[model samples]
Target chain A: MYRISYKAFKFEAKDALLYRIDPRAKLFVALYSMTISIITFDLTTLILLTIYLMIYISLLGKILRKIMRNLLVLTPLIIIIFLANYLVTFNIITSLVPAVKLITLVLSMNIFFLTTSPDDFSLTLEKLGVPLTITLAFSLSLRFIIVLSKQLNEITEAQLSRGYTLDRGGLIQRIKNFIPILVPMIVLSIKRSIDIAETLEVRGFRTDVKHTPYHDLKTTRRDVVFTLSSIVSITIFYYPLQDILSLFIPL
Target chain B: MIEFRNVWFKYDEEGDFILRNINLTIKRGEVISILGDNGSGKTTLIKHMNGLLKPTKGDVYVDGENTRDKPISELSRKVAIVFQYPEKMFFSPSVEEELKATLKNFGLEGEELNNRLEEILEEFRLVDLRDRTPFSLSGGEQRRLSIAIALSWDPDYVILDEPTTGLDGYSRRDLTKTIEKVLAKNKTVVIVTHDLEYLFEFAPRVILLSRGAIVFQGSFKELLENEDVIMRNGLESPKISMLMKVVRRDGGGCGMRYSELLSVIIERLGCSEDV
Candidate 1:
């Protein structure tokens, strides 16, 4: 019942300063960091930003551990990105730039998703003038990801219980073995989508009406402090700070 | 026999236990019903029997083999679990191909595979729909096909998780017949369900779980006898059982089914009508 509230990004109800910041400020930080990480190609600056993210995460209490766990799952993707960049550029230092940028982006966003509640994030979107339907669509897709992963796990178990061995065969045979799992997944996914749509209708969901949010969002001093620090950190990446830091810390 | 010896399980190390110290035994050929409210670990218990999940603290033994020692595929040769949603198990192009795939997975081939395929299709009344894709079949037909796939390999223990969910009266009757067939084969069938009426009809041995502990386990008649156990667990007794409770309060004897309950009520009223 509480899977959605607690399982998404392993959000914890903490008393930390990061948890107290306005979700709108947190969202700006996450998206802005992602934008900078994509545009800026300096490997030294990226690594320094990654270090800053790690330090920032440590200040949030035990969330650093959870963030590391999420990043571990993305290690393979990071390696693939690194390899692809290396094959094209043939420069070790240049290849490290994209990988370091991904780590920084993931770390920065993990702070947002881990600290902010789903309701708060949706409200942030609405506060920024997004339509209710679009916000619901976005939030529902994120929520259903947990459901889909769970369904996939159950389907895999069901197939295994039928004595189906996925790892025992040749490449062609192994790919063929996935059919039993894939078909059921597709069928269940379709059924789940229909059920969700029906539920929305039954619950009187409408796209035409305006909604009054229950909780009033208030931006406190912590949010202001967080936003200022985030802006300062973003600026530090562009100035003589990068030049000075690159001399001290070799890439 | 399936033995759960002090079995305790949690999904992760930091998570709370879902099944705690569940020391229970299910003998061969015995029809068992596992009852519990949602999140009380009914599905988790059945998953343990099939070796799909391993107990975190203790051991589960199926047919003298420790589940912790065997892979799920190896343990599944002895235990077949038909999940609540049958659609999650279908990936074949057609119903016949589905059965053939399961049989082939069990290492059957040639004439034996073809024979088992035809036999299962005929038994489940899927021979007519055998050419249809599983996704195209009706809900009841899909359920039947899923059960047929499970039974085709002839496992010693068959577990049905909420087999009656979304099934109509006719489809439930079909499920009853299927359960009867499984029992007649002398195979142990375990049903994890919330359908009390279905359980009353069969009156199988029941294990009631609450808060990760087995609160009650005995014959269904004994379970009905202890209305407090059922009520305390926030589960309603089957309607017939509730009606009989009123009858028994007014000096009627025990009965589980409708026919038996009718005779008991008539005897208590001291009236008989010729039909």
Candidate 2:
């Protein structure tokens, strides 16, 4: 279950400051961070951006632990990238840059997702001029990921109770053990998908019709201030901050 | 025997405890029914028996070993749990294979394994469905198969979580008979359920839980006699028990079974009419 929490997209309805932030503002922050990470080749800028995202995530309080756990799942991939880069460049500093960049990218996305609920995310997408179908599809996919993972965990435990050892044996043997889990998950998911489609049909869901949304995204003064501050910070990091730091850091 | 010493559990560290300071001791060969409303921590309590979950505070000792010390597979040899919606756990192509896999897990092989497999299939009345795909079986058959798979190794303790959820009357009766057969073998049974009527008929000892605390632990008769406890816990007494309550209120003796209650009512009516 923890393995799939990163994709769960749960909405915590708490009175926290981060929870009250507008989804649109969070989304822009995510986009700006990603753009900066992608365009900035200098290591100093990437490191600074990574630090900023880390501090932003720390402010999330309870959600910070979940975000960290989700990031732990990416640790192996980050290490692999670091090793691959080191093998090619034979320089420790250059090798570390790609790992930092990957971390910055993931942390930025996590900031958006961990703080924003699925409903808010879809509403943000809808307000951003995305078609309703695409937004629905996105939300539905996120929902199914959590559902399927839960089903998988249940199936795994069921087999485990029957004396099946999933963690034993070699890699191929472990994959073979997962057959019992995967088969039921796929079958159940297909059955669930059919049920969902039937329910949608019964509820009069039509792709051609323009539907009225019950909840509309509203931006407050906080959203404007947050978005502007994020853009400004990104601009500073992308333009002058890296050059100023480079004089002393030797990057 | 299973014992929980001041167990407290919550999924999140800072979240309110789901099972709070739960202290219990379940003896061997005793059929105990855990009754509670939703979110009362019934499921969380039973999962401790098999080491699927360890206590956030205190300890869960199975047989004499702390559950925290052993893996679930090691604990499973003694405690088997058939979860609610057990059919969703089925992954085998055929019913026979499912039971076979469980027996194999317990290291049973050759003639002994085959004998146990055949015996459980016949015991659960799944002989005809032995070759059928587990998913293709009817709901009752699927549930029976799930129980059969759990019992293939003949664990000393069997836990059923809401075994009658979607079962029809006939299936429910069949399940009760199956449970009776298991009890006849003297295997300790623990059932977590909302089916009070079934609990009234089968389980001798009832443990009522509310908000992660055990409010009552006694016989069905004691539970029936306490209207305040039953009503407060949001539980409806069995129909026979309710009738018995009405009879006792009018100065008639209480009876747990329908036949006994009917006789009491007839005796009361005859005496009143004669006067």
Top candidate (lDDT): 1
- Candidate 1 per-residue C-alpha lDDT over B1-275 given as tens digits, one digit per residue, 9 for 90 to 100: 99999999998778899999999999999999999888889999999997888899899999999998898889998999999988888888898888887888788999999988888888888989989989888778878888888999899999999999999998888888888888899999999987778886577899999989999999888888888898888788776876877887766544365556777767767788431
**Pairs of residues at least 3 apart in sequence or in different chains that clash in candidate 2:** none
Q: Residue-wise lDDT of candidate 2 within A77-145, one digit each (tens)?
A: 999999999999999889988898998898888768877777788888888889988998888887777
lDDT of 2 by residue, B1-275 (tens): 99999999986676798898888999999988999988899988988898877888999999999998999889998999998877667877888988887777688899999999889988999999999999887777888888888888889999999989989999887898888888999999999997787775563688999999899988877887887898899887667676766888876544255445656777877855333
RMSD of each: 4.2, 3.7
lDDT for each candidate structure: 0.84, 0.81
Model 2 Cα displacement at B194 (Å)?
Answer: 2.2
Window of ten residues with lowest summed lDDT in model 2 chain B = B252-261
Flag regions of model 1 displaced more than 4 Å: A1-20, A34-48, A60-62, A76-99, A117-137, A197-222, A233-251, B245-275
